[model samples]
Target: MVYKMSVYYRATMCITLMLLLLNLCEKGYGVNLRDMQVPCEEVYMVKEGETLNSISEKCGDPFIIEENPHINDPDDVFPGLIIKITPFRLYSYKF
Candidate 1:
């Protein structure tokens, strides 16, 4: 009977320690929505009467600025174009 009681007490202590460690680790690794929340980059759809200057004002500046050599070429951007105002970074979680 004494041996059985000792074994049961040890098992109980081990289970309790395991539970405590698991709880602490979960809190350390869990991601809170507010902590990870990031603002979405604003994108503009080119309109018929929109100009680059106006778009720049509305969307701030682009991360990259490349000037097209041919302003009148077929690939030249016009009003009502979709432009990305911000770049995104990939994030990894390490626990």
Candidate 2:
């Protein structure tokens, strides 16, 4: 009788925990990529008053210097300067 009761209790606990986890997941507890506005362009032209860091954040590309080898200097960016943009979010699955 005791053995049967213990098994029943364990099964009930497992089911309860699974329900709690499902509830948390439904409440938006993880990354929802659908809500993000990721840029689709592979090439981008720098606009006036925009720095590399600002462009990185705006375009979602974190490795602007590595992608664009022509940028001899990070601070030499100017309006009409074309640069390659590959968003970091696209390769996030590798990690």
Candidate 3:
């Protein structure tokens, strides 16, 4: 009778430990993930010699204008030329 009781108690302890571990696994590290979805917006032209970096600092993320690499030579932008700052992909996931 004593041996049966001991075996039963050990089984109960193992089951309890398994349940606690399962509970901890279910409540994983709580981190809220977010998708950075910013929309495109327009920005007015600045005076000559202004740079994209400077404009980004003043305007903010998802910067006011999307510069076209094809036409917008970083070294040669003219004043009064409007530019479209379109939404561009910023991140990717691989698995």
Best by lDDT: 2
> Model 2 over residues 1-95: C-alpha lDDT tens digits?
99999999999999999999777656666644455455647778899999999999887778999989999999999999998898544422211
| Candidates arranged by lDDT, highest first | 2, 3, 1
Local error of candidate 1 at 14, Å? 0.3
Model 2 alpha-carbon miss at residue 82, Å = 0.6
Candidate 3 per-residue lDDT, tens place, 1-95, comes to 99999999999999999999766645652321233344334545656777666655544544443345445455566777666564453432322
- Candidate 1 lDDT score relative to the true structure: 0.56
True-structure Cα RMSD, model 1: 9.3
lDDT of 3 at 84: 59
Q: Which residue window of length 10 is worst by lDDT in model 1?
A: 62-71
Model 1 over residues 1-95: C-alpha lDDT tens digits?
Answer: 99999999999999999999778656765443334432334554667766656555555453323432223443456776566555343343436
Model 2 spans with C-alpha error above 4 angstroms: 1-36, 88-95
The lDDT per prediction is 0.56, 0.81, 0.57
How many pairs collide in each candidate, listed in order? 3, 0, 3
Clash pairs (backbone) in predicted model 1: 46-80, 46-81, 47-80
